[model samples]
Structures are given as structure tokens and as C-alpha cells.
Target: MAFKYSGSICSDLDKIRVFIDEILDKLNSIIKDQDTMFDLKLILNELVINGVFHGNECNNNKCVRLYLEVIDNIVRIEVEDEGKGIDYDISSYNSAELKCCGRGLIIVNGLSDEFYVKKNKVIAVKRIN
Candidate 1:
């Protein structure tokens, strides 16, 4: 099955949290457990925040979209934004720390079974094992 969630909001950081929480809730219902949901939730939140704060440069006029898909026993999450893509080293981020926001994408890479990115977008995948 395929489910889609999207938001076009001001680039305000607060709005980023709200929209991500909203999308995470909708996807959690279809997932297997709380752990999975939480993982996906964290990854989703990070991507959304990155898209707004860093990618779009806090342009309130821009928006982002998140797409969820379940296929072949795997869950896929895609985040797309209206802003230009960011070029960061996903590998060199600090993995363990109280403040890991600097390595949000790296943390996401560790949590996801598979991760991919494209211009203006990112995708996180987890196999429901």
C-alpha cells in the first residue's frame, strides 16, 4: 500500500516540527510497532528540519513533502522540498552525543536500512524484519 503526506508551510522552524509530527502520526498507524515508528519519526523530523532550515534557508514561502510506501515487506519514506539540495558528508557526522543535530542526516543513515538522496529530496527505507 502507498500513503502520502505533504505540507506547504512557512519556513518557520516551529512549523517544521508540526508538519513532521503530523506526517509521522499518519504513517505510524500502518507500521508494525512503536520502535519502527519512532525511528521513522526521528528520521522524518530531521529531514524536514534540514529541508527548511538549511536547504530552503528558512524561506517561509517554500514547502516540503513526505511520501510513505510499503512494498515487499519494506517501508519507504521520501522527503522532498522546494529548496535546493544540500551537500553534506553523511559519513563524517558524530553518531553519539546529546546534541546530534549537527549529524542529523548521519543519524538517519544509521537508523535506516537503506538511504538515498537526490537533488531536492531524500529517501529512507527500513525492511520490516
Candidate 2:
């Protein structure tokens, strides 16, 4: 079976919760493992938050596009924002120390089996057993 969701949402932090809930609801039947669900939630939150805050600069007029797909026990997540793009070394944030900022990408990278950034879009993949 395959489940997919491709949609766009306003770049507002307040809308993230509802958007995530809707995605989770759609995937509930496919993903039953609690750990995988938690990881997915975290990944979704981090990516969306980053897109809204850093990419779109919290501008509600802008929109964040999201694409989620699950097929053959593999989950693919993509988030795109309406900003220029990111230009930084992702590996530089690989530290165990806890900081207030600059941890979202690290957390997302650690949790995801595959993670990458292309222009204004972030993509992550996870294998659900």
C-alpha cells in the first residue's frame, strides 16, 4: 500500500501543529510503530519550523510546501519554503553540546536515515520496519 500527501500551508508556526496532525492521521494506518511515529513527528516539526522561521522569515504571506509519501515501508518527506535558500555547511553543526539554536537541522539529520537539502527544500527519508 502507498500513502501520499502533497500540500501547501501558510508559513505560520501556529499552523504546524494542525498540519502535522493531519499528516499523522493519514499515515496512522501505515505506520504503527511508536518509535517511528515519534521520529516522524520530530522530523516534521523541525523541518517545518525551519522552513517557516529561517526560510520564510515567519511571513504568513509566504507558503511552505510539504510532500509526504510512504511506499514499501519507506517514508519520504519533503519541505519547501518561499525563500532564497540555505547556504551553510550542515556538517559543522555536528556537536553533542546542547544549544538554543542551530540544532534543528542536526536533530533532523540524526533522526532521518537519509537527509539532504536542495535549494529551499529539505528532504528526508526513513525506513519503517
Candidate 3:
């Protein structure tokens, strides 16, 4: 079976949880593994939070576009924001820094099988068991 979700959500922090729950509901049947689901949830949270805080600068007027697709054992996630594109290199991000902030991309990169940023969109791919 295949599942997909392509939609836009307001850049409101309060709506992120509801959006994630809806996505999880859609993915429950296709992804039965608890660990995978947990990882996906974390990934979604990080990406959406980044889009709201960094990309959109917490602007409620802007919207974040999300694309989620699960085909067989592979799952793909994409998030796009309305603000300017990324300025730095994502691959060179240092997760070991002693800072308290800016670890979202690092966490997403570690959990995802493949992660990349293009323009205003960030994409992550994971293989489920």
C-alpha cells in the first residue's frame, strides 16, 4: 500500500502537533514499527519547527508546505517555507558544538538515511523495517 500527504499549513507552532498527528494517523498502517514511527515523529517536529521559527520567522501569514510519501518500505518527507532559502551548507553542520540551539538539522541528518536542502525546501528519506 502507498500513502501520501501534500499540503500547506500555517506557520503556527500550535498547529504543528495537530499536523503531525494527522500525518501519523495516515502512516500508522503502512509503518507498524514503533522505532520508525518515533523517528518519523521527531523528524517531522524538527523540520516543521525550523520552518516556522527560522524560515518563516514565526510569521503567521506565511505557510509551510509539506510532502510526505510512503511507498512500500521507503518514506520521503519534504518541507518548504516561504522565506529566503538556506544560506549555509547542511552537510558541513557540526552536531558536536556546545551550543544549545541549531541542532535540528543534525538530528534530522542522523536519523534520516538521506537528507538534503534545496532552495527553500528540505528533504529527508528513510527506509522502514
Write down the TM-score of every candidate. 0.78, 0.92, 0.92
Candidate 3 TM-score, true structure as reference: 0.92
Which is the winner by TM-score between candidate 1 and candidate 3?
3
Candidate 2, 26-115: lDDT as tens digits: 787778998999999999999998999999999999999999999988999999999998865676774676664668888888899999
Residue 70's lDDT in candidate 3: 89
Rate residue 90 of model 1 by lDDT.
67
Q: In every candidate, how many clashes are there? A: 1, 0, 0
Q: Encode model 1's per-residue lDDT on 37-99: one tens digit a residue.
A: 888778877877877877777788887776777776678878888877766566656556555
In candidate 3, the residue pairs with backbone N, CA or C atoms under 3 Å apart (3 or more residues apart, or in different chains) clash, namely none
Extract clashing residue pairs from model 2.
none
lDDT score at residue 126, model 2, on the 0-100 scale: 93
The runs of at least 3 residues in candidate 3 whose Cα sits more than 4 Å from the true structure, single-residue gaps closed, are: none
10 residues in a row with least lDDT, candidate 2: 93-102
